[model samples]
Target: MLTILDKYILKRYLATFVTMLAMFVPIGIIVDVSEKINFMIENKVPFLKIAVYYYHFTIYFANNLFPIFLFLSIIWFTSKLANNTEIIAILSSGISFTRFLRPYIIGATLVSIFVLIMGFFVVPVSSEGFNNFRYTYLRTNGQQAMRGDNTDVYRQINDTDFLYVNSYNASSKTAFNFSLEKFDKDKMVSKITASRIQWNPADSTYTMYDYKKRTVGALGDVIVREPEKKTKFGFELEDLTPVIYIAETLTLDKLTAFIDKERARGSSNINIYMVVLYKKFSVPISAFILTIIAVSVSAMKRRGGMGMNLTIGIAIAFGFVFFDKVFGVIAEKTTFSPFIAVWFPNFIFGILAIFLLRNAKR
Candidate 1:
C-alpha cells in the first residue's frame, strides 16, 4: 500500500534527521571536551571514565536538542525537494497536497514516540550520570554539588508531626540543631530536640546526641534527658534534604510519587518538580508540532532558496527555546502554573503550524 512518493519522502525525512544528529553531536562533544580537558587533567580523571561520561553526555544532549535538529532537518530536505521541482512534479501527477503530507506526519509520529521513550526512561538515567560527572570534575571548591538553596530545612512528616534541622551536611549524614514536634489535634503533645543527629546507614536509624524530650499532659509536663539516643524517624535523609536534581533523576512513576510526597511535606518548590514532569511529555509533543511547521514553511520554493528556509527555521527554533525558558523561570520564580508554563509554547506553535499548513495547502 506504499506509494513511491511516500517512500521517497519518508526515507529522506528519517535520513536527514539522523545525519543532522550525527554531524552536530561530535561538535558538541569536542567543544565540551576542549572546555573541560584542563579540569580532567588537574583532577587526574581516568581516560575510560571520561569516555564513558561523554557517552552518557551524548545521549543527554541529543535528547534535549532533538526537536531543534528535527525542525532543521525537515526544513533542509523539504527545501531541497522544492528547489529541485520534485514537489511540483508530484502535484502535477494528480497527487493532492493533503496526500503529499502523509509521509511527513508518519515521520513525525515515529520521532515523537522515540522521544517519548527517551524522555521518560532513558534521559533520566543518563542525566544522573552526566550531572554527577560535571559536578565532581567541573566545579571548584566551596561550590556545593547538591541542589538546594539553604542549609536549614523544615519538613512536615505528617499532619501531626513536624521536623526541623538548623543545618545538614549531606556527605557526613549529620544534622545540627534537630527538632521533632508532635501535635494531637491543635494541642502540643510531645517535643524532642537534639544538639546533633547522625544517620547510621547500617541500621537505618539516627543517633541523637544531647537529646531532650518533653511530654505534655493536662495535669503537667514531664521531661526526659539523655546523652545519646538512637531512634527511627519517619523520614529518610533525602526526605529531610533533597538535592535540586532529584526530580531530573527519577523516572515517571518515581517522579509522580516524589511530587506527591513533597506536596504532603509542604515543599515550596513543587512547581519546579512539576515543570520537569510535564516537560517530559511536552517535549515529545512539540516534535510533532514543529515538524508540521517546518514542512509547511519549507515545502514551497522561494526567491532565497534553502538558505532562506534555514534562516527562518533557526529563528523559530531559538524563539521556541526562549519561550520555553522564560515561561519555565516564571513558573519557578513566581506563582505561575507549571503545567501552563511547560505547554504554552506548544499551544502557540500548534496554532502557527495550522496557519502555515493551510497557506501551504492553498
Candidate 2:
C-alpha cells in the first residue's frame, strides 16, 4: 500500500543523499591529494598504490561524515519543498505531517542499516588500509606511531602473572627491559627479568636475552640465569604492541572481545577503546535522529527560504561534531564514562528533534 507521495518523497530523500555524498567526496579527495601529493612524490610511492590508498580514504571519509551529509541533504531538499508550497499542498490534501514523515523515516532506516554495516565491517577494513598507508608513506619519519598513552607498556597477563616492558618497537617485534612477575595468592612466587625480548615467529615463542629468574619458596629462594631463553608466555606479541587505531580495525564481535581482554589486562586506556565501541552503534543511530531534526528545522516556509534552512543545518551539524569531539576528549582524559560521552550528544539532539518536530507540527 504505497502512495505516490510516499514514493516521491522517498526517492528524493535517497537521491539527495547520494548526490551530496558524490559532491563532497570529490572535494575531500582533491583537498587530501593537495595536502599529500608532495609526500607521495617524495616517498616515490607508485601510482597504483596511491590510487588504492585514496580509494580506502574515500570509504573512510564517507563513512565518518555520512551523518553530516545526511542532515544537510534532508534540510536542503525539505526546505526546497517548503519554499515551493509543496508541503502546504500536501497538507491541504488531507495528508498529516506524521504521514508525510513516513518516507523520511524509511529513508533514514535504510541509511542507518547501511551505516551499521559500514561501521561493523566495511569501515574497519578500509580504516586499516587508510592508516597503514598514512603511516607508511605520509608520516615524515620511518618510525611507526604508537598510542599516545601506551608508551612503556605494562599489563597483567592473568590472575597470577604481570608483565612490563620499558620500550617496544612494533615493526621489529622487540622489547627492552622486560619483566614478568608471578604471585601465589598474596605471596610472591617468582620473578623473571630480561635485558631484551624478541618474538620468534617461526616457533611462536619469545627469545629473552640476558634472562634471569628468581623463585621464592618457604625454605629459600632459587636463582637461575641464562644468556638467552626461548619461552612461550600467556600473552602474544600483539599484546605487547598496541597502536592508536587498533580499535578502529576490529569488527563488532572482535572489538567486544578485545575490550574484555584489555580490561582483564588492567589497561589504563580502556575508556578510549570503549568510546570507539560505542560510537559504532551511536553514529548510525544518529542518522535517524539527525534526519528527524533536519526535517523539523527545514519543513517550514520562511522569508529566507532554503538558504536560511541550510545555514541552520550547517550550524547544527558543526555543533554536533563539536559536542561529540569535546565529550569524547573528556572521556579519554578524565574519569567520565565512555558510554555517556559517546551518547550524550545524541541524547541532547534527540530532545531537540522532538521539540522542533512538535513546533513544526503546530
Output the number of the lDDT-best candidate: 2
The runs of at least 3 residues in candidate 1 whose Cα sits more than 4 Å from the true structure, single-residue gaps closed, are 142-231, 240-243
How many residue pairs clash (N, CA or C atoms closer than 3 angstroms) in each of the candidate models, in the order given? Answer: 1, 0
**C-alpha-based local distance difference test score of model 1:** 0.86
At residue 142, candidate 2 shows an lDDT of 44
Q: Per-residue alpha-carbon lDDT of model 2 for 292-358, expressed as tens digits?
A: 9999999999898899999999999999999999999899889999999999999999999999999
Candidate 1 lDDT score at position 356: 94
The CA lDDT of each predicted structure is 0.86, 0.87
Q: Pick the candidate with the highest TM-score.
A: 2
Candidate 2 weakest lDDT stretch, 10 residues: 142-151
